[model samples]
Target: MPTTPAQPPVFTQKKLPLLRTEELMLNMGPQHPSTHGVLKVVLELEGERIMKATPVMGFLHRGVEKLAEDGTYHQFIPHTDRLDYVCAMYNNFAYVRAVEKLLDLKVPERSEYLRTIVAEVQRIIGHLFWLGTQALDIGAMTVFFYTFREREFLLDWFDQLCGARLTTSWYRIGGVERDVSQDLIGQLRYFMKEFPPKIDEYNVLLEKNRIWIARTKGIAIISAEDALSFGLSGPTLRGSGVEYDLRKAEPYGAYDQVEWSVPIGVNGDTYDRYWIRIEELKESSKIITQCLDKLPEGPIMADVPQIVAPTKDRVFTNLESMIMQFKFFSVGFPMPKGEIYCGTEAHKGELGFYIVSNGEGKPYRLKIRAPSFIHMGAFDHMSRGYMIADVVTIFGTYDIVMGECDR
Candidate 1:
């Protein structure tokens, strides 16, 4: 029995199979096309799923806030154009509104209606740009072409209004740069009639698409509480079902006179955000139409000779008017020795300007609450657990323009 006891089988480490595991590191861009601009994202991936995302900004930073300190109130108007270059008129509107608020200036009633109509037109152009780019990012080539076609019409209209399409520095502190011509009004009226059908075409192309639905329906969701915590606004905030629109909550520029509803979404997904922008396009058109109908006959600029620039005719003929215009351009009108913050409902979100004055022509301190920058703070929260490919969808969902974000 003792001889029958055999040696036990020896265990060998080499015979057991080994499992390998590691997290992948990926740099999404400072140059990636889908990034929307010079944005770089450091991503930690676990089997193609995003575990963490850290956004690296400043690639496009030109110290815009610092630049604001070096210029007069009137001189700074053109600077805002580069912030959201896609919708430059809105940038102009938001900036001048802030400056006017600081001065306690009153804009003429006709100017308010003009501002509202132009702003809504800018909204439609912005939404079209967003829709086309977003659909293009999601592999829907047809929609990009279709949306841009409509967008070109609006851009042409902008050229007619301001003589510059992309960076139209047409808004003034006390009012707009000029009055809208009757022909321009006719063009807008025609666009209002023709654009609704084009929106329907976009819906037909993307709404029923299986790929688009699958990519966006449940992706990049954040609750209403979370969105508010992240300081989201405009369509991004409304996409989470929050009924906070500055146009309605705090009326300015004929918005109180017009009637239109804010579009809200149930689920805070990318698709819901897309839907919100589409609905906003319709609402913006309605706002513009109502504004035109109620457009008044009065002065476009305020009659504050001390603050506003003189008319071209006055500057040409009157020596005092010429001197005032020269002084206004060289040294800006003095602001009160205080600080003020003003926010406007831009297409992307609430574009805000906070200024500090020392009774000087130039702002002592200036800060911009850019929504692209704010929305980026929520990127990691929204992007986690999503597949790698969904990152582009998330970027487009925010309608991000790094000109604003990096500034």
Candidate 2:
């Protein structure tokens, strides 16, 4: 036994240039399943903790604002449907209201109620989407199937409302395109009764499951002040205990006329946001039920003959009605030369539109203050001190849609 042959003394450098700890950069998505749409998030990480996060957008840009400038006010409704396709009715409702604000046009009471019904339906659809995807991101696949199934019924309701499902273009400048029928009302009544229980089932799966709580309980906490400073609205803002819902704060459509309350949260974490959206699902159901019960008995379209399209019978039988319909569709009604910004409580947040009119059929310049876009800006701010895994939770809880964000 050579008694551990002590070869030469090896100089084990005691302080080796302070182990250069280079930051690790990671991109979450531009084509990810969890991200619903094309969203590339650049994350700077040290081990599993995040330092800085930048959300890279424009992957779904269609020059929507510029497209608004080129198209007529009515023509842009379909474009808006493409913005937040998961909540196309809300998109249609928001843009139409924005254009109507420029014209100072009055929507009929019946039309307002109808708009509210569809808008709330869109809310349910949007939140169901958020819930399913968020749960899926956290490794709960059953929630997605359950939510999307209920959502499909809502889509069919939208189809009955506008003949198309996703981009229904149901809402028009002064009013909605079609009125809800007795059959549709019956369907909603059935859904309103049946859906609350399903939400409970979802809660059973996610509300306090060990894995869910472990992953989301303390992740991505946003303070009330920081939430407002970040321009967050809808569930994200309310989840921070702000009670700053546009539906309650600045009532639009039949929101002021109706009797429903906006839900608020206490923790402002992922779980709080999740709970807020779940409550919103109930609130939205209540709104739809009220709208259906209090459904007015009058015309759905506004009195603005220049803007609203004539009925098909009127268009086919009468010469003046035909010409007016043609003129309205071909050139569109001219609005006052002014600027107006109108906002609505969309599924994600306060989806708003600012229109600059040149006394023309089309807008001079149009700008969208999309909540998804604004919410994503706070990513870098909110995800600073959280772990890299928490960044995904933040994105899910924030509920961003790249179509709306990029546009």
Clash statistics: count for each candidate = 0, 0
What is candidate 2's lDDT per residue for 15-74, written digit by digit as tens? 458687678999888877767789988989876677789888889999998888887888
Error of 1 at 309 (Å): 1.0
Q: What is the alpha-carbon lDDT of model 2 when measured against the actual structure?
A: 0.84
Residue pairs clashing, model 1? none
TM-score of 2: 0.93
The top-ranked prediction according to lDDT is 1
Off by over 4 Å in 2: 1-20
Root-mean-square deviation per candidate: 10.5, 9.4
Error of 1 at 278 (Å): 0.7
Report how far off residue 331 is in candidate 1 (Å).
Answer: 1.3
* Alpha carbon deviation, residue 144, candidate 1 (Å): 0.9
- TM per candidate comes to 0.95, 0.93
